[model samples]
Target: MEESEELQSILSYLPLLMRSSSLFWPSQAVETLRELGGGRVDSGYLLFQAISHLRNALSLSSEPLSPSTALGYALFFDEVMSGEESRKWFREVVPVLGNLLLRLPSLLETHYQNPHNSMRTATALRLLDSQLPGIIFLSQELIAALLGCSFFCLFPVKDRYVNHLPVINFDELFASLYEDYNQKQENKIWCIIHYFQRISSNMPKGIVSFERKVLHLKNDYTHISCPDANFWSTSTVPLCRVEVHNSGLIEDQSSDAVEVDFANKYLGGGALGRGCVQEEIRFMVSPELIAGMLFLPAMADNEAIEIVGVERFSSYTGYASSFRFSGDYVDEREVDDLGRRKTRIVAIDALCSPGMRQYRTNFLLREINKAFCGFLYQCKYQLYQKKLQDNGCSSALFDAATSTSMETSEGKFSDHKTTNSQNDYHSMDQGNNIGVATGNWGCGAFGGDPEVKTIIQWLAASQALRPFISYYTFGLEALQSLDEVAHWILSQRWTVGDLWNMLVEYSTSRSKGETNVGFLHWLLPSIYGHDEVIQTQLHCVSCSETDKRVVGMEAYLCGLLAHQHRYGLVDYSNYWMLCVALRPFISYYTFGLEALQSLDEVAHWILSQRWTVGDLWNMLVEYSTSRSKGETNVGFLHWLLPSIYGHGTGMDFSNLA
Candidate 1:
């Protein structure tokens, strides 16, 4: 047959073999073809025909093929060939493989991108990474030959380019691998460290870089000499000298001239009395100066300064010079006698600037006063509440009796008698103890229908008593109320600290305790003017604790009392009064809206607070400007301006600002 006819004939049977479910037939047929082609005079021709058949079969097969099938076929060809014959077979097979690969991009675009295909992209990449290594190694020459073909011949440019790619540098590949490995290792180490710290009280110190020595010295400062010094002795020698001249003019000279040779008098290399000039003679300084010079030597050459008796002084020339004292001695006070004597010590007082002392004292006094006032305020609130409870029982009883009788009474005559008797006695009692009756006496009426009233009061007192509830039934109910408020606040970019502070202030300032009642009345004209204690109760309901509901509630109450005094309503509170009050607000707000606001308000608030297109654009600008550091306070401004303009007012940014 002609070459074209031969190729066509081979291709016809290829599809049938490739699609056959019986792998045994295809393997045996491939083996028979390989053996027959090996002896043919036109071996290349027969091999090429066989390879073309396989390629055609691969292309035409309608049945879905597993990766194992492709692997099996490749392995079969590899096992049947050797040397030149193997090269020839690989060369013929690669073009078909290249053609197959060329179809991948299109296949990916269609099969992978199509939502219906649902191909696992990661699995595909992993498979490629795994299979490419073997293909590149086994058919290196054939793949290289195919790469040299025209881009449009049988395969696309991308396929040919990838197939014939050379081995990447081992160093670069290893570097990448090492980096990835190191990062994973570090992550594991960090995870171990965190686990140990979290799960155990005692943790190994190996993970931490702690100094074991007392000083934890990074460098040997005590022994190292100055870099300028020739040796340890040279660095340690004092630079100052006192000399008494023949003219009786005492003058100071640089001690740099006092070399190690001159300082080491014990060497005895020169005779002490030889060529001595008595007229120009002068006594050397004290031995203490010489003793101060001895120290351990530094090992490093650059560590010369470390050996110096004192830290090297700053100078333009890089060498430190010592200060000197020079003066002519009086006739009675002999210069030799002064030189022989020990250096007199001078005692001096530590001097401080007037402004510094004043500022220090002022800060100290302020802190002390603040602490004292805080203590006094706490005591006063406690005493006040105790006294109110003790004295207000009579009025509370009167109110409770009146309320109960009104609800249960049958007729006007009975009601009149009850009212007249109670009122006549109340009027007379009120005349005498009006202050006590009006203040503390009212709390006894707090308990109405213990269940219903408690629930309502609890609902109303959410901010105050929420932290104290042992049962979560009310909290679950409250959560529905808190959702809108929390979403509104958290959706904004306020820092936790700023948000926390604001909630604290609002809760504290609006409490309804007796002391805060006066301020609540004052602020009533401005806003809702709700009772401070009730407002505090509402804020407390927002706390996020799981079991300490009662603690949270009492904290809220104490915070309310503290805040009232802090704002001058109670006369002795500290600056942190508002901060304390707002603590519950932050906690509860985080718990979600069920603890705070009604569903309607929450939904409306959340919808209204949604970021608008303009706001997003502004945020982009703000983010960009912040990255470039073009503006100092853009973040704060973004938060504050919108807040002041009522952007998040319904959610309450007043205290935060």
Candidate 2:
């Protein structure tokens, strides 16, 4: 009965094995084939060894498959040796097996046409990072399934992962593996050869070639502070807050690329985007200067690169998709302390695309710029202005590339979203780049998502080795929230490093599809200590201890009140007022009031007159009418907070009318 049950289980796995499950243990087969190629296994042992590996890999996959998958090849083995007539036919396969094992990449390459060839594609994609193993054996069904496809696929292998493959002459291995078991057969050998040639011809150029880029940031006076907060709101308009040029096409109006006899820094697209800007600058700038930005250092998430004092040799018109070359103009820009033009170009890569399962950070295998040019270049203005406010650094004329991709994801910082156009690969081919023709090329600073741009610049400041970097943010209400959060962390006595670690954790976790993660979510578990005030029988001490444990919503409010009570806020009753005053627009989350009661808080905020009196009256009437909770309505609050706290109730709506 047990044997019959096992057989039934084996039958269940047969279809999955035949279909080429991506989870299968081709690695074991890979190892066995390599061993066979080492000449340790003789001819008679070849078929048996290959069959053993296939079975082992399947069983180890933890998915149930039929036992026949591993053992059935032995049955065929016996038949090949059944008589002299069969022996000749079987002998043809022995030498071919060894050669095929050595040419695994080409074998995988040939299998691209299979509809269910993800494993083959996966294997091929990992070819640069993995060693080629010998003699991969799946069931005959699996083998046939792989060899049946005919399509084109080339997964881009970034520069960072190419060191794993052994350096060998693939052409020789492929040539040696091409022997037809029955080469004399006109029909069999010719068709196989023709197919091999076709697949080999489709190989992409520089498929596994990549190199590192290097550019240095002078530590004149700046040190990169991790997770740029940019929290300070300056009373005076910052250089970043306004554009100096009169025209939207200021870049075009600037000294023509040819007329600007010299510059110290010029911005470019990126090293990975064919270094488009740098490539164009080559027409006017020195080739040596252009080469400096080439192959710069790798950026981790939220990192920025600044190439200082690179002279812009040419000027152009149009933005992305519609970019064009216009006539050159003369550059009259002043020199800096180092006597280099105060020109700077920055590279800021987007973290990750929306909804991608992987976060791009130091953990990424390969990284390139996305659409973060908006925040990156804008922040450069902020930094450059800051640097000027302090002092200046030495020479410029270098290049910069963002170290990693840190997309402005809405994981820990609030669910902020960018409304950039969707990225389509065929944009250029379809002529969709120039839609109406009068668009801007600049990745204008992220005006809508204040938190994203602030965090990005602040984080870059933390990691950079520049002379001066500022973390002041002009994030309106968001900045106030962060300031309060910082105070809360201080009250908790948590270190800045610990908070940075959590920031990294939240960034990575969210990018990788982790859910229920917030910047402060981890703090929740820590807040709940021990989970016990355990005592079965009631007593004075126990009852007192139970009282000490605050579990209700009121307990949380009381605790928070006590914590803020110590902040020396003069009028603690006006806590809501202070929050509303500092941040022009207030969310319930401004002080954890939203979680307590959205409607009640909104009503109270209006009656407090922290906002306009009209808004309070309007919302109060709306809430009174909706839920009939008129006790907490605006009129009651007018007497409770506003009227009592010095606000005059609007008896006349003359201005509003």
Candidate 3:
């Protein structure tokens, strides 16, 4: 009687099951439902209908499933899941089971703990065994082996790995599948990396902190100076501020070569005699005579050689690329609280980029202290940095890593790997957010992973007191995704702790060359519902690329992107998707690379002005590649040479005659 009623119940809704596909459901499910609709299998549709009703149950009920319905769900689920559809639609299937399983305690009562006679107890093994591995990249064969062997053991593991179907090697499988999905997924993930809000634009305005009435003035975090009638100057003598230049005395050159006549020219030669009594004073004593004696009979903590400052004879305005002359003004106000307009300039010995080691974190921090020690007492810069890093302000920044300024390489591609050791990654002002204007921080000029470095910088800035990051993304679609990814992670409510662990896992998997289980996987979980990800074939950044063989007006601009996989620029897949999608074979390279080569010569020919290594990164991705999307060859070069990182330094783009 029960079986007859169940069969009648399944028949009522089996006709309503049409073709449906989702990330959680297999494409084969539509056909499977079609097969069941043909009246060939009545029992199979019965199992299918029971599972389908679970979705209806959840959509309708906020409460748990009834005791009887939950038990029936487990038995029917077991019957249908013995088929391939269970594995294919595993993501959709598992959630229903978990929800129904919630009612087990109510149904079994006390026997729920160890119900040997209960069907729910009998079905408990299936509940545990039926769960599909949540990870998407595992080959179908590995998955089958995993399912067969249970969670803890790998005995059923055949020596072969598999894709949606089957494969021989684990490493080789991901090597092909990974990059294909990464770039294809990025196509759908269009990040708004750069937003240059103009004075006249309708974009959002930032909170400007300028002159306003405030409570008290505090220098850094220490040394608060407040006005009170109680505090008064005790000393009658006027005081002079001493300027410390850690670089050593500016005018005190080494005493090596000097004739007796020149030496005694003005009471010790190079000394100036203004004839005034104050200007005629000469100094020929050790530092100890003027300041405190050295500590530990070695170096003094506050010991600094007094350095002089001269008035700047010129003036300039604007920061970075906006710098220009805005007229000069005379400075008559000389309060000189620290010194008489003096600057203790510590001049370290000049050193070129010595094999790139000079820019490493450990090395750079070593150099920062040359000036830090001089201002340690009065300046709270270092102290401020410590406060920023430790105060747990990372949650405040959601879009920190959203800025990136790089593109795919034009030559042979090699997978980049990194280990997440946040300790090794240090910034002196880790949390200061103090005007850190940077581009290509760990790539381009140095050998490093652009993605990893960009992530690290974002993580550092997230904890900063005032992070004013400027990512010059150069209008590249790929670069913009960094920020978009950051935005999505935040929108999904992933915390810093979540991202840090995800990165560590991703880095570990990256080093092992795992498929479908890294940064993008963590950032965008929605893409992995279907094992087979849909991807568009590669197109030139110059979508309207001209044919090189059939010579025409712009035939010279054609250059082939080197060693493209099926997805062109992405370093995956052996098979290109379609002919129209794949770019036509040209004899040259990527638009960025070719344009860079041409711009180099043009920049020198037009004017002798040199380009800085970071010059191309202007206002976060608005640099050299801004016009690279459509223009080809000489036209690209012409636009680029001027605008790069072209349009050029001051060349006008207007065709105004």
Give the best candidate by lDDT: 2
Which candidate gets the maximum TM-score versus the true structure? 2
**CA lDDT scores, all candidates in order:** 0.22, 0.28, 0.25
- How well is each residue in 1-657 modelled by candidate 3, as lDDT tens digits? 122222232222121221221011223433433333333333323543533443343232232222333323333334423555333333333332222233222322222233222121121111110112000011111112222111101111121111111211112111222223232111111110000001112221111000000112233232223212111111111111111112322223121100000011112111111111111111111111101000001112112111122122123332222323233323232222212222121111111233334333333322222112211211122233343366556431222221110112111111211121211111111112122222333333234444544444343323221223333433423344555555554444433334444455445545554433334433343233222221322221121122222111111121223421223333212111111222343332234554345543543443233222123222113333454654333453454444544344845424211
Give a tens-digit lDDT track for model 1, residues 536-623. Answer: 3333212121222222222221221111121222211122223222333121121232322232333233335543222323434455
Error of 1 at 559 (Å): 6.6
Sort the candidates on TM-score, descending order: 2, 3, 1
RMSD of each: 41.9, 24.3, 36.7
Residue 159 error for model 1, in Å? Answer: 22
- From the highest lDDT down, the ranking of the candidates is 2, 3, 1
lDDT of 1: 0.22
> Candidate 3 regions off by >4 Å?
1-435, 475-477, 516-522, 525-657
